[model samples]
Target chain A: MNIIVCVKRIPKTAEADIFIEKDNKDIKKDNLVFALNDWDGYAVREAVLLKEKFEGEVIVLTVGPDESKEVLTRCLAMGADRAIRIEEPIPNDGRLIAETLAKVIQTGPFDLILTGVQAEDDGWGQVGVALAQILGIPHASIVTHIHIEGGKAKVRRELEGGLEELLEIKLPAVLTIQTGINEPKYVSLAAILEAEDKETKEMTLEEIGFSPREPLDATIDQVSFPPTGKRAEILKGTPDEVVGQLTEIIKRKKGS
Target chain B: MSDIFILVEHRQGKIRDITYEIFGLAESLANQQGTSFTAVLLGHDVKSFADDLSRRAPKVLVIEDENLEHFNSVLYQKTLSSLISKYQPSLLLMGHSAFGMDLAPSLSVEKDFPLVTDCIGLTFEEGKLKATRSIYGGKVNASVSLRESKGYIATLRPGIFPPKMHGEIKGRIVMEASPLEGGVDVKKFIEYIEAPITGEDITQAEILVSIGQGIGGPEHIPMFEELAIRLGGTISCSRPVVDRNWLPKERQVGISGKTVKPKIYLAIGISGAFQHVTAMQGSDTIIAINKDPRAPIFSVADYGIVDDFQNVIPILKEKISDMK
Candidate 1:
């Protein structure tokens, strides 16, 4: 049961100070830090666990320019048998990326494909499902647990209101894994050094027969800070006095 | 023929609230384009839900299939693609819920339609549709537009649109049958296991007093629980509390947890992350108490107190008791 996992490189959102560019069409990348997206870490771990248990190969793929190779190498250190990086300077468009991924994936007879439910940067959560559709296979999103038996993939999908749905799809399906499905393992410096000798492959858009004659299906027009919807009325006083004022407001509101 | 098609989403024979929210956007867009809108329901034996939905729109398109009694995206995509090819509505809408998130992206790709997900607002300026979506963990908003296409598909964030009632619009219902042969068999549904309601369902609560990692330790939970009870509310916490085994999974509030809309919410000690804020920001009133003045929670809060919740909770409880 060979598996292919898709990964992406994103800015370290929590540590970075994000600001919209003067053109309002992009973000300021001067001091921002980049790493493998947090959610994709879980995806890579899940794939490695499956390969370790089932005795099959795991291949990881990513789409970006030169810098994305860092994440691909990290996946190899973590236990993916091989890594593939599509060398292309693409916009942050989910559909366009999914198309390129589908073309590259056509080269393999993978039994399963996994991806983070959403990227931390754009948070589109669309690429995995769109790839499944382009390849004409079944897919599920927000999957928290997965078990394979007899060429079938049984998954637990997380739904709103604390509900879980148990589903089974045939082999060769796509699953967009949710966060916290498992605690991703930590990689040590020793493992990173060992990974330097592993196999890493690179492909171009033209190599994959992906030629775009038209514009992206959807693109960001402008970016800006979210409006401070309602400025909070800051209650400034000693704790006791402020408590008194809050109590009065609550009493009046409850009465009305 | 500019028409909007809102896919009616339901589970276990009960309609989801997002189905109504979609009507709000569809109505506004339809009015702007001088066209009609249809509420499309696809399930087994959905007559009652279709009837209830007819009062809200100009038309309801009902499609029934035994395979659709439960949601399998393969079946939904196949059925919806056929419907779109036959009708060719200018716009299609759905809720950005678990089901919608699973279905819309694949459908858009299969049909070569432009799609956008997790939208908060939509506008038509100069005859082009622009959608506003959140980025940078809800700290920024990006306006996006679709390239030239025949139609567009969008999934709206729940609780963002204001649902309106149209008592006078008695809509007509058009019925149809499944178009596929034996429903595509890419996947099969097994069962739905609802996480047991260990305590109150936080999503149903009117008032909620929620805590976060800053609650310091497990021993401090009882103090906040008492305050919540006194204030006629229930206690809830962020995902970390549940991960720490300090609280039950039922009490967690966030994207992976539960999306709740309460009348009054008090966020105590929670550093406002987008995952946490998107779940509770729909509350009618929000009050945040955190020692750090720069906590993101204060930005969306209606009232803020930059003080230790430990000192503030006790005094606020005493004051409420005295008022009673």
Candidate 2:
């Protein structure tokens, strides 16, 4: 069995310096530090689990500028057998990324494909479904658990009302993993050294045999930090008094 | 004449709530632009759904195929991208649901258009599309506008816009043959495993009693559960609670988890972060109980208590238990 995991490089929120570009109002990404998106980490971890259980090869793929290799390297260090970098500096939009991935996956012979439900930065949560569409395969999003046997896969999807729907799909399907699926393992020092020596296959847009059909017209016009909220007023009083005051405040606010 | 396009999302042959919400939003934008709203539907046996959508009064384009009976991004994007190019709508609106998330970016990339995902608010001015989204998780609201004008794409955050009933406005539904040839042939469906049953999902709870890092650990959850039982609500937690494995993933609420709109939300020992706030900001009433008065959760809170949750939670549970 072969499983492919789609990974994305996103700006780490802790180190991200979000500011409006002088000429554009959109959030600027000039100095933001990048890392693998949180959900994608879950996808990679799930693939590793499947690899362990099924004794299969796990391949990690990412589409971004040349710098995206950093994330692919990290995936390899985490135990993926190999990595593929779809080399392009195109905007990290989900659609473009999915399209590039679809083209790449079309050439590979994998039984199952995995991706995170959504990336932390864009939170589009559509890539897996889109890739499913592009590949013309049965796909499920927000999947919490998956079981595969004899070319049939059983998937449980998280739905509203604490309700989960069971879906039965055939082999060679795509599944977008939600967070909490599994804890991602930290890359061991030995694995990191091995990853450094592993070669990555790089593909370009032309190599994928597709071009942007039409130019997307949307752009971030401006970006700014949200205003600081009013500070909470601390009332020093007895517990009874505090409870009374809190109740009064709640009543008043509800009335308003 | 450029028009606005809205994708209608449906599952199990029924339109989702966010579909109407996006329509309501698109209607407003179309009205502001003095342009007509066009809706696109892709699925198997979508004629009935299209008929229902016509009551909303937007021009409808229905693309039906057995392959599309289930949601697939490849076929939807290929079909919708062709329609978008042919119709050339000035703006496209879709719900920020999983379906929209998958289709919008692929459409944007296919057309090489920039896209803004998960927008909470949208407006138009001087022939430009303006959208506002929560940033830094949900701490700050940032407004953005599209630079180019051939078309713009946006996915609206669910629950932000209320669905409106526009009465029956007769519209046309044009069924187009699937433009996708040989249809996606690479993958196949296998099976679905159901998630392990936890308690009720907290996002759907009308009233939620949430615990945070301050609640200590999993051992302390039962005390909050008592409060939840008294209040006729569900017990929920912030991400840290789930991170510590004190609660199941179903009970976690935040940006990465489920977005919730509860009526009465009690925050016990939760320091408000943008990620967590974005999920429950739609609550009718918010009450925060934290030892630190400086916790950000108090900013949007309707009621606040700057006290140790350990002391407050047990007392509140007792009071509610007595009231019952």
Candidate 3:
């Protein structure tokens, strides 16, 4: 019952203002704190819970530059048995990341794979599903509850419009966890100190037997704020006056 | 010939609304490329579904199988990939809903196609497909262009484009079988469980009095609840309120939560992050009140007040009570 969880290092969006860099290609990284993606925290916690129950290992993996080790280390501190960071300044392409993960994961004896439903940066919910396809295994996304029995795992997937679907997938399957799946435990300072002794492995793209695929053909042409149309009429004056005006407008619309 | 293919999505014996929205986008895209609007329907007992879709597209391709009765990405990828290779459509569109997110990623990888998910807009300029996607939630829009790829795939955000009937005439429906040796065998279907709708279901509310981080703390929630009750609407909140446990999960609106299309949306103290904006962008009338004049919610709001909601809610409540 070995579990593998994929994590990503992302800038804390809730903290500072997001500034698009001068290159317009990526964000300004200076003065920002990087941490495990919010959803991935749940994946790491879930994997650790499964490992604790089944008495197996929980391995955390990531594909990024050297700084990504912080995320893997955080996962280790949260009870993952081992941490592996693929030392590459990977592109934003989900396919490339999926390819790298698939190559590295196939070498391990893993019965399950877990990842965040989507990354906070690119917001592309592709890597987990694509990785499962590359590994030729069944996968489910937005999974809320997972129950493992004999060689199969029964999980519940959150669908649109407040509905949930249940599926029974065999072992060696991929599951992308959604938020609120569980309240991730807070990693104490002592746990971080203890994780310093645990193993943290590093791998390169070539070491994973990865031949570089053709660069992804998609490129961001331009990034800009959504245009503000001649729509919202800003009300001026004190709170009382503004509230009166708004109430009048709503009344007129309601009557119409 | 290069065609625009729309993968029709359905649940509980009814075609989802996003399928028609895809048709709306596909029809315009096909007209631009001088190709027919082609819809690919895969489901069980899809004869009536195909018939309904005939009014939307000139060609509806149907694939019916009990295995596909419920969506399995494995089965859909196997079925759609064969169809894609056979048709070689230049463009493909699907909803960014649960099913499309599950299917498109794997299918794109298997087919080696350039893929973009959760697109709000699409256009073709100089033979390149530029897809408008939201990054960092809905705060910014990035125009992504496919670089000379043979085919393109985009999963469009639902409710952004309204579906329209093309004409009075019904188009042709062509039935096809899945090419898989046997139906999806890797995963077994267990059961479909409806996520318990906690507290109240506010998704279908006509008037939504929504609050956000501006509410300060749990003690301030009753004011908004009373305001909503007075207005004969329901009380909702952004994710932060749910995170604080001020409201239940069912009352939250955002990408990870539920999408709501209300008639009159009163946003109080919400900073209007993209995650929150994407869920309620389809509302007919949006009114935002925040202390910060720079809140992004104002840009999309139909009416905005730059002031403290605490100062304004009492006045608003009084005015409404007087009018009633």
Candidate 4:
């Protein structure tokens, strides 16, 4: 069996301060630590797990610039057989990205394809399902569980308000994985160093048949810091002093 | 027709609030464009939903089938694709929930419609569709515009568009046969598992002591719980805490978890991702304690403490107990 996993590199911004770039269309990436996207880590781990159990090859794929190759190497260290990087300067649109991935993925009658439900940076959650349509294959998104059963995949998808639905799809399908599907295993430093030598076959958009014929559907006009809905009043003084003030305020407010 | 259509989303026999939320946006946009908005519902024996939706828009389209009782992307996609071909509307809006997250992108691809997902704002500028989407865990917002297209598909995030009700409005109801020929056989539905109620329901709590990743670890949970006990409150948490097994699913407050509007919601060590904020922003009074002054939670908080929760929570707990 041949399984393909898609991953992307994103900045760790949840805990860090992010500043809008001077262009107002980008963020300053200098100080932020970059790593594989949170959900994609589970996707790669699931791919490796399926490969280990079913005796298949796990091929990791990424679409980005040179630095994004780091996520591919991480996947390789996590037990993927090989890596592929489609050189970047790709458009920011999801359809264009899906089309680009489809042009290369059509090269195979592969058994399964996996991707994160959404990228952390953009969070559009569009590419994988769009890729499945562009490829004309069955697809499932936000899948939380998977069990392979003879030429088909039985999967559970997470729904809103803590509900889950189970379904079965034919082989050669796409599954956009959600976080918590599996624990992303940790690899030692030596393993990562060894995997750095593993092959990461590179290809450009021209070589992969990406066309600029159709104009992009959507384009980012600008970006800015989110509007603070209603700024909070910061309590002043030491922790104990603040607690004393807070208790009074809580009592005042809690009483009506 | 260049009309706007909203896919009426329903579950367990009731129309989801997101359906109405999208309708709220479409109604105004349709008025601005001098065009009508329609609500297209797909369900089984759910004519009541269609009737109920008719009061919200100028038109309501019902496509009923027993097979559509539960959402299967395959059947819904096929049905929606045919309907789009027939109607050729300019826009079809859906909630960016699990349903749209699974259906909208793929259907947009299949129909060759320009698509946007998880939008917080949508407007037409110079006859072009523009959208506002929050990125980077809701720390930033991006304004995006779509190129000219015959039609488009977009998913709006929940709680962004507030649904408004007009006391008296009537709409035309149109019923169509299911466009899907024969049931979808390729993908078979198994079952839906509802979240188990392992303990207390946080939604009913009057006061909530909500914790996020900054709570440190499971070992520190009792300390937070003790604080909750002192204040006569229940313990709730952001998704990460539940994902880490620090709390049960019932105690989680977020988009995927329970939406709670307590009397007092004291958030500790939470960075207020939109997912979590959308759930608890309705609290009567909100307080946040996080060391990071830049945390997004502070924006929505009514009161804030910029000290390490380790510093404030213990003292606050002691003070509340002393008052009692």
Candidate 5:
């Protein structure tokens, strides 16, 4: 069963100070470190594991600028057979990304397409399903477990509140893999260097037959810090001083 | 033809909270825009659901079929596609839950409607749809404008909108059998597996020492457990800790986990993803101790300490002991 895994490059914003650029169109990139999207780690790993078991080719695809090649390389180090980076900046709209990827993916024949449940950046959670719709295939999102047998698959999709629904779908489907689906293997720098056998292919929008059937429907007008209506009072001091204040607050508040 | 429609979501014979929450927005928007607002209820043996929804909208279109008994997005797309074409509602709303995430994008593509998912803020200015979406792991909000079109679609994050119901006469209820003629040849629904809830109920605890991925590894959980005991609290954790099997599902706090509102919620080493924050923000007091000063948790916390958990834990224990 051949597979296509969609990986994304994202800013490490969970622990960083996100600064909206002055233009208000995107986040400031200068102060942030970027890595493969955390959820996409499981996506690439799941693809590689499936390839190992089924003895087929695994392709890691991403839609971003040249900087995204690094994530593709990392996916290759994680044992993906090849990488495809469509040379375009990441778009704010999920539908456009899906369009770009679908056009490229239609060029190949594959039994399955996988993507992270959502991007850590926008958390739109739309690209995979949109891509599936564009390709006219069945799709399931937030998939926690997958078992492929014959030409069909039995998959468990994670619903809210500790519930999972088991569903069976035919092959040539799209699944947005949820986290904890598997333990993503660590990509070693040595493996990154030794990924000589695997290759990263770059493509332009023109090459991918990029033509908007309809104009993009949504545009991110501006970006800003999340409203700080209930912002916390930061304890200013050494660890001892901060701990003194925290414990004091806890002492008064605990069991209140 | 240009109106508003909200997909009424239900599970296990009860209307989900998000459906109500979205009603708060859908009804008001429809009133302001002067377009008819209808609620679309799709399910089998769910007439009561429609009856309940009738009060929320001017009209409730309940499309029932055996295949709709369970939410097969495949069947839903086919059914909703025909309904959308027939009604030609200008705006459609769905909850950004497991259901919407699975359905909205595909509908947008198939319908050629402008799509926005997981919007926390949605409004129409002069009949143009705009939305506020959280980006960068919920650290930033991106304001978006949907292109002009006859049809527009948006998904509201479940917890963002509160449900509104005006006191008035019930609206009309229209019943329609599912239009799709054939069965779902692909994507068959099996059984729903509910993880057995076991262990301590952290939701009841007055103080919760919630650990996140920042705690490093499972080997360190005992240390946090000890800290929890010292603070007279129970040790709960974020989704990642549970994902790593460091803690049981019973101890997880997030959208997919338990919604916790302890007297004093102590979030340790948690960056405060919107999922975790949404659950615990109702706590009487939220104190976040994360080394990352910009962790989103700090924004919701009553007090915050930008320091290493390891260093803060010992001193916190000592200070609490002295105060006691």
Candidate 6:
């Protein structure tokens, strides 16, 4: 089976700090740190799992500028056989990126394509499904488990109320993996060395037969931390006094 | 004026709540822009829900297909793209639920339109659609505006928009035959495994007592659970609790877990982080108990306690039990 996994680079949760731009009240950017998106890690892991079961080449693809290579290399080190980077900073527009990725994925005769349910940066979980739409393939999002047998693929997706729906699709389909689907494998020293020599194919918008359209003019005007609240008073007293104070606090705070 | 399109979601003949919420949002946007609101439903026997939807929007389009009874991206996109070609809506709205997650991106790619997901709010500004969404999980909020003349598509986060109220605005329902274009074929539904039932629906629980790494270990869970039971609420935890295998993934609340909107949310020993807060910030009231006064959770919390959860939870549980 030929499988492809899509990954993205995002600001790391712990390192990201959002600040409003002076000129725009609606725009904000993080100045601190960035890393591979959490769910995309699951996508890469699922692809690696598929390769382990089906014995096929896993191609990890990311659409972004130079900064995205970090995630592609991480995917390579994580066991993807090869990597492809779309050498352009796809704008905040989800549609443009989906179109570019759809075109790129169509070039390969892939049996299945996997992507994280959403990027942590924008939390737009729609990209994988949108790519599948453009590619004209069966697609499922938030997939927690999957198994490929014969020519059909069986997938379980998490839904509301702890309910899961199992779906079956033919080969050459798309699926967006949700987190907790599988544990991402750590990059071994040997694998990192092997990935350093692996060939990475770079595709330009022109080469992919698509022109960069004006980014969906979505501009972040400002970013601000939510307001803080009053400090909690720690009631320290005799056991009886503490109990009385605690009861008052709970009644006043929780209203129960 | 440009038309606004909304996708109606349903399963087993029952309409999803997000569907109504998306329609409510679309109705508001359409009324504000003085444009028509068109609802498109794709599924088997989905036409039955159109009558109910007509009360919310100006027009309804039902594209019936047995293949679409379940969410099939291939069929939905083919049908949606055909509809888009027929009626070029200026903006398309969908619920940012599991189905929307699967369908929105694919439709955007097929139609070559700008798409945004997990939007909490939307408004038109200076002839452009402006969307507000959280960045870095829920640590910060950002407002974004769509660029040019191309159509805009977005998926609204659930619970952001309130449910639409019933009214007397009757509309028309247009039944469109399935386009049935060539796309990926869905074989069948293999099986539907319901996640093992937990005690309560934490996502809908009005009160949630969430535990963090500060809870010591698995043995300490009963203390929080006792409080939850006494309060007639449910118990949840941060990613670390699930990561430690102390709680099942279903009991976890964060970016990777379920988004909830409880009336009262209590955090014990949990440091507020963007990933963890985004899933629970919609709660009506938030209370954080952590030893570190600098814990970020205090930022959005309505009440904060600078103390150890271990010492606090047992006493609180006892107090609640005594009150009962």
lDDT winner among the candidates?
A: 4
lDDT of 6 by residue, B253-273 (tens): 875577888878888878765
Local lDDT at A235 for model 4:
94
- Which has the better TM-score: candidate 1, or candidate 3? 3
> What is the full ranking by TM-score, best candidate first?
4, 5, 3, 1, 6, 2
By summed lDDT, the worst window of 10 consecutive residues in model 5 chain B runs over B160-169
What are the per-model DockQ values?
0.55, 0.24, 0.56, 0.77, 0.79, 0.43
Name the TM-score of candidate 5.
0.96
User: What residue pairs clash in candidate 3, if any at all?
Assistant: B138-B274
Model 2 CA lDDT for position B257: 66
* Candidate 5, position B16, lDDT: 87
How many pairs of residues in model 4 come into backbone collision? 0
Give the C-alpha interface root-mean-square deviation per candidate: 3.4, 5.8, 3.1, 1.5, 1.5, 5.0
Candidate 5 local lDDT, residue A24 = 85
Q: Provide TM-scores for the models.
A: 0.88, 0.73, 0.89, 0.96, 0.96, 0.81
Q: What residue pairs clash in candidate 4, if any at all? A: none
- Chain B: TM-scores of all predictions: 0.83, 0.82, 0.86, 0.96, 0.95, 0.80
For every model in order, the TM-score on chain A comes to 0.89, 0.84, 0.89, 0.94, 0.93, 0.84
lDDT of 3: 0.83
Determine the backbone clash count of candidate 5: 1
Candidate 2 vs 5: which has more DockQ:
5
**Cα lDDT of model 3 by residue, B131-174, tens digit:** 98877645567888776777888999876787876567578888
Which window of 10 residues has the lowest lDDT sum in candidate 6 chain B?
B181-190
lDDT string for model 4 (A202-225, tens) is 999889877654578889889988
Instruction: List runs of model 3 lying over 4 Å from the truth.
Output: A14-16, A31-33, A235-256, B125-127, B197-207, B213-223, B226-233, B239-246, B254-264, B269-285, B290-296, B306-324
- Highest DockQ scorer: 5
Please rank every candidate by DockQ, starting with the best: 5, 4, 3, 1, 6, 2
| Order of candidate numbers by lDDT, starting with the best | 4, 5, 1, 3, 6, 2
Candidate 6: lDDT of B57? 75
Instruction: Give the alpha-carbon lDDT of every model.
Output: 0.84, 0.74, 0.83, 0.88, 0.86, 0.76
In Å, residue B125's CA in model 1 sits off its true spot by 3.9
- Candidate 5 lDDT over A59-84, as tens digits, reads 99999988998888888899998999
